[model samples]
Each structure stands twice: as C-alpha cells, then as structure tokens.
Target: MTDRQITTTLTSPEDTCALAARLGPLLRAGDVILLTGGIGAGKTHFARCLIRSVLLEDEDIPSPTFTLVQVYDTRQGELWHSDLYRLSGPDDCVELGLTDAFETAICLVEWPDKLQDLTPETALWLGFDAGPQDDARNLTLTWHTPRWDTVLKGLVA
Candidate 1:
C-alpha cells in the first residue's frame, strides 16, 4: 500500500508532549518509531513524554545523545530510545545490539539516518520542524505498513 501521513502544528512544548502521550498507549513490542529532526526540534521531549506514559512509575528520561541508547522496562515490554547522531555508520548499530532491539522492543529512534539500510520498513516515521512561533513545532507522522493504521484508529491521527 501507499504511505499514509498526518501533519499537525504543536503550539507549545506541552502540546507536543500531549500528542506523544496520546500515541503512547497504542504501542507494543516490535513497534519502531523513527524520529527525525534537527537540533531543538522537540524530539527528545516527545520521546520522554511517550516513554513516561507507558511506564508504571515516574522517572527521568534523558536524551540518548552521548549515551547512544537508553532502554527502559515498560508495561508493553522493553522500550529502546536511541540517538544515532554520534554513530559514524550503521555497523555501529549492530555492535550496540540495536538491530535486534528494533525487532523485539518498542523503539523510538532519533537521528535514524545512522540506521542507513538497516532501517526497518515497518517503522513509523515522525518528522519534526520549526513552526512560525519560537516554541511551536511542526510534526508529521508517516507510515508505510498497516500496523500503524490500527494504532492510529479512532484518533483520526
């Protein structure tokens, strides 16, 4: 099937987090969400909110910038949040066990360009960009597989 997409403008950081939390409950293991955006585009905030929404307790969710990857145990299963910006190539992902995690865990990946050919065909793609307002962010969600169709059902997302 063809790709399906939805675009929305987040008026503020809270609005961005709200959207992330809205999708959080629909996730399951084996789901991959590729987050792409420039610096300060609200990627980390959205990921932090989504991860917290699935967690049973409150905890700090830091950007996996220098750390590369952060794994959390959630109600759905293991959640892998990875920032591949520092990686020189896709081979680094294999060494980090990210290729396996993408198949078994609920993954939210930032700087997914580093994944190269290893990028999953079933992954949901979220692109973030700056909006007219300083605090506003334009978010676009895109998917090629039918998996996200069910996840986005009823939400008109």
Candidate 2:
C-alpha cells in the first residue's frame, strides 16, 4: 500500500462542504473511506456533504451516531455511511455487514479505529484535526488504492 498525505484547512461548514463536493464526483460504488478524528473534528459534517453532493440533493443528512449506519441510493449506486464509535469491537463489523458493503457500495466510516482489522485495505483515509481556533478544521486525506490516486489527482487539480 502506498501512503500519501494531503493537508488542507476548512474555514466553515460551507468550505468543508465545498471540498466534499469536489471529491464526491470521483467516488465509485466499491469505494471505502475511513474517517479518523476526535470529537468535534467535523468528520460527520464532511461526510454529510459528501453523500448529499453525490446524490445531487439538498436533503438533511444526519450523522448516524446512534443508528450506526445510514444508506443512500444515488444514480451511481449506494452510499453507505457508518459511525462505529459505539461498537464493542471488530466482532461487531459482521453484524454491521461492512464486508459486503465494501463490495456493493461507497462507504464512509467514522471512528474507524473501532474496526482494527476489518476496514478495507484499499480504503481511503481522511484524518481530521481542529484548527487554531473558531470553527476551522484541518483535514488530511490518504489512500492506497489505484482508483484513489486518480481521484486524488483530480482533487489536487
């Protein structure tokens, strides 16, 4: 797997949404995204933007914090959003059906550390950090999949 880092700052929720909008077009059905960050790091906010943009709809996309997972169907395919913060362990992954999701849909997982050995090897990782102050946020994206490299190039362009 190849490791690369991309650091960028987002000023507001709109800015975060804009970045997600730019990246959303590159996602495919089998893509997986692992989001890592502390509380208030804007992981869910970024994901909401991503899925909504991909669906081309301006609907309310709530964080699946308690429900654990949410699915959206777009013309491209299914988009699955999962928040595993409340998971007991990797054993819970099968219950969530993540392995199958990896092959059938585009997945965005928050609190990815909960699934130690279950996250797809080709999954793209997006790490978030709180900015200096206010509502600012810093995000770093990395991926090992060849498809991700192509997407990264488009994002960087």
Candidate 3:
C-alpha cells in the first residue's frame, strides 16, 4: 500500500464537525481511525460529529474517557468509539474487544498512543494540534493504504 498524508485547518468547532460529517459516509465496517493528540485537541468532538452524521436517530454521544468505549448502530453498520487514555497497556485493547471490532466495525480510537503494538497497519491516523487561534485546530490525516487516497480526494481542497 502507498503511504499518504494531509493537513487541514479547522477555524472553529463547526469546521471540525463539518469535516467529520463529510468523512462519515465514506467509512466501511472494517475501517479503523486512530485519533491521537493531547487533551482538548478535538478528538472526541470529531468522533461525535462523525457518529451523529451516520446514526439513524438522535443519540447522546459522550466522551468515552470513563466508559472507555461506546458502541453505536449507524445506518451503515456498527460503530465503535473508544478512548484508550485510561488503558494501562496495549493488551487492554483485547479486553475491550477492540481487536475484533477493528475488523468488524468502524472504529474510532482516541489517545491511540496507548495502543502501541496493537495499532492496525491499515488504520487511518488523524492527529489534532493547537492552531494559531485558540478556537482553531490543525488536523493531520495519514494512512498507509491506497483506499484513503481516493476517499480523501477533494475532501480538503
């Protein structure tokens, strides 16, 4: 597979949400998106928007910080939103069933650094960063598979 990446700026929460919404429809069951960044970096916000975008009904999308993982039934299929921050080791991913979900559901993992060796090779990695403006955010998207190149085309331009 080919490796590729892109960087985009979100001037506000709306911008970030819009970006997430745009990507929602493109996800397939096996897709895994690893979100990495520091606190308040917009990882959950992005995941929330994405979940809402494809869901069949209104749902309260909460941060999985304490709950660890949240499962949703989107119109497309099962979606797993996970927060690995509280995890003590990569093996915790197995206990969460994330290892299996990674291949069967659309998975969004926040604080994926905790994943370490368990990180999926084909997963898309999206990193959030503080932008120049306090309300703005810089997002970097990277993937080692060719499918993303087609999926992300024109999404940023």
Candidate 4:
C-alpha cells in the first residue's frame, strides 16, 4: 500500500494524551508507531498516556532513555516503548531486536528518525512539532500503508 498522511495541531500534554487515548481504541496487538520529536515535545508523555489507556495494571510508564526499552504487559497486548535518541543508525535497531518487536507486539518508538534505514513500509509515522506556545504540541500522522488510512480517519472523527 502507498503512504497516506494527516497532520493535527495539539495543545497541552492533556491534548496530546487525549490523542493517544483516542488512538488506543484503534490499536491492535501488532501495530508499530514511530514517533519523532525534539526534546520536551511530549513524546514520552504521549507514550505514557497511550500505555495508561491500554495497560490493565496500574503502574507508571517511565521514559526508556537510559534503559533504551521498557516493556509493559497490557490488556490489549504487550507494549514495547523504545527510545532511540541515543542510537546512531539503523544497525542499532537491528542489534536491539526492534525488528522482532515490530513483528511481535505493539511497538511505540521515539526518535525513530534514527532508524531511517529500517523504518518499515508497514509502520505508521507520527511526528510531534513545537507549538506556538509553551505546553502546546503539533502531531503529524503519516501512514505508510492503507492499513492505517481508516485508523487516521477515526482519529480525526
């Protein structure tokens, strides 16, 4: 399938989290979300919100900056939260077994631009941009396959 994209301006962490919550209902067991954004752009916050929406357990979802990856067992499925900001290239992705995670679970990866070479054609690209004011964010959703076209529509709806 060809790529299809959508963009949305989000304000506040709550707004970003709301988007994540909305996305939660649309997710299946094996979906990949590649998130790109600068520091403080709310990527980790969004990830946390997404996890909270699906995780059956009441636990904190920490940013995996140092650990590299954090795994959470959710009601929907296993959620793999990966932070690739420190990664140098696509090789790091392969070494970290991310390709396998992509195939096996619902993977939410931050700083995915680092894995440019390995970004799959089936993965969904969700970018966060700085907004006009502090505490505001802009999320741009780009789909690499038609599989997400309906999902994106639901997000907007």
Candidate 5:
C-alpha cells in the first residue's frame, strides 16, 4: 500500500493532547508508533495523552527515558511506552523485550532512531517540530501501512 502523511500545527499542549486522545481509541494490538523529535518537542506529552485516553482515566504516565520502558495494562491490551535514547544499540532492544512488544502490544516509541533497521516497517511515524509560536508544535504523521489509513484519515478529518 502507498504511504500516507498528514501534517498539522498545534497551538497549545491541549491541542496535542486532544489529537492523541482521538487517535488512542483507534489503536489496537500490533500497532507501533515511532515518535521522532528533538528534546522538548512534546513526544512524551503526546504519549502520555494517548495512554491516558486509552485507559479512560487521569493516570499519571511517566516518561520512559530513565527506566527505558513502561508497560500499562488497559482493557484493550498492553500498551508499551519505550525510550530508546539510552540504548547503545539495537540488540539492547531485544533484551528489553521491545521486539516482542512491537508484535503484540500498542507501542509508543520515542527516539526510535536508536532502533536503526530494527524499527518495524508497519509502524506509524510521527515527527514533531517547533512551530512558529513559542508554545506551538508542528506534527507530521506518516503511515507506512494501509492498516492505519482509515484511522489516519479520521484523525485529520
């Protein structure tokens, strides 16, 4: 299937959170989201929003930077939030159970460049950038598989 991409400018953190909340319900097992952005680009915030939305609660979602990975149990299944920034190589990902989670859980991966070729081909890629406004952010969502086409379309709609 052809790849699909959508870009949007979020003026505030609430806008970003709302976007994540809308997308969260559309996600399912075996879905992988690769988040790419520089520090303070709001990747973690976006992830937390998504996770909390899926859980349908105001849970405290923590960044996985220091701990590497955090797993959350939801009614739908397991959701994995992983930060690969601290890993030295892709092999470390296997040791951390990322490979397995990528196949079975809804994975939100930050700094996925650390995964190199190990990154899944079917993953949805999100690239965030600082917007013109100080508190705004530009988000680009790239879908590599047709599996996410409808959901992506709905998100932009």
Candidate 6:
C-alpha cells in the first residue's frame, strides 16, 4: 500500500462518468473498488459508466440495492457490482458470494463500510461528498496498492 491519494471535483454527472470511463480500462480481476457516498450521491451512476466502459457498450446497469449483487460477463472478465447497504454484517457478504467474487472478479462495491473485516486491504477507496455547488460532487480516491500507481498516473494524464 502507498500513501497516494487523488482528489477531484465533478461539476456534473458527466464528469463522474468521464472519470469512470478513464478508470474502467485499468481495472482487472481481483481488484476491488470501494465506493462511499450518501444516498443520491451518484455512486450508481459512476458504476454504470464504469461497467459500460469495460463492456465497450451501452448496457442497462440496474442498481444492486435490492439484489445485493449484479454480475456481468465481459471480454476482460467477470465484473461484480455490489451494494451492501442491506447487509447486516460482514458475514452476510459471504452468503452473497461477495467473498468469492472479491478473489475472482472486478468488484465495484457500494456502501463498502458494511464489509468491515471482509474488506480487502488492497482495495481502492473512493469517497464521494457533496460539493459547494448544486449537482457537484467531490471525489477523493485513495490508492492502497502499488498496482494502482500506473493506473492513477494514466488517469491524471
């Protein structure tokens, strides 16, 4: 893990989507992205953009709020989008196959705080907060693994 962090201001949903598009190609199996944000904070929107970028197509990405997890097959590999808001504890994630997916798939996790001990130490954490202006969001990306250094550089480029 490195003490590297990137912060950006997204003025609109398009900016968030653009960031996701840039990040999508750098992801791979076994990578975990923990998304932290309050309700209506654009986490799902960002996930949708990332999934579409990875698939190289415009696909309907429904929120995993109720289902807990949504799996998508892509040319790169399997991508798992998970919303842990409904989970009661970290153990509950095991039953949802999140534990297995964390090892085999590219995981985009919403409400990742619920995972507690199950959370991967190498996971990239993206914290979202409301910006000063309406419709703006402040995104703080914290990198916890050396593998993300090049990817983060590319994103800045």
| Model 3 worst lDDT run, 10 consecutive residues | 1-10
**Per-residue lDDT of model 6, residues 1-157, tens digit only:** 4568988899899888999988898899999999999999889999999999888455789999999999998666999999999889998999899989999999999999889999998898998999878889999988777878877885853
True-structure lDDT of candidate 1: 0.91
lDDT of 2 by residue, 28-134 (tens): 88899999989988899889888988884557788899989998886679999999999988889788898799999999999988888887888889998988668
Q: Per-residue CA lDDT of candidate 4, range 1-157, in tens?
A: 5667777778788888998998876787669998888888888898999889998878977899999999988877788999999988889989988888888889999998878878877788888889878888777788877779867775753
Per-prediction CA RMSD (Å): 1.1, 1.5, 0.9, 1.5, 1.3, 1.4
**What TM-score should be assigned to candidate 3?**
0.97
List the candidate numbers ranked by lDDT, top first. Answer: 3, 1, 5, 6, 2, 4
Error of 6 at 13 (Å): 0.5
lDDT of each: 0.91, 0.85, 0.93, 0.85, 0.90, 0.89
- lDDT, model 2: 0.85
The C-alpha stretches of model 6 lying farther than 4 A from their native spots are: none
Tens-digit lDDT track for model 3 on 1-157? 6768899899999999999999999999999999988999999999999999999899899999999999999977999999999999889989999989998999999999888888999999999999989989999999998878888999985
Candidate 5 structure quality by residue, lDDT tens digits, 73-136: 8756999999999899899998999999988999999999889888999999999999989989
In model 2, pairs of residues that clash are none
Q: Each model's TM-score, in the order given?
A: 0.96, 0.93, 0.97, 0.92, 0.95, 0.94
Pairs of residues clashing in candidate 1: none
Candidate 1 shows a clash count of 0
Better of 1 and 6 by lDDT: 1
Model 4, poorest ten-residue lDDT window? Answer: 148-157
For residue 66, model 3's alpha carbon misses the true position, in angstroms, by 0.7
Off by over 4 Å in 3: none
Range of the 10 consecutive residues with the lowest summed lDDT in candidate 6: 148-157
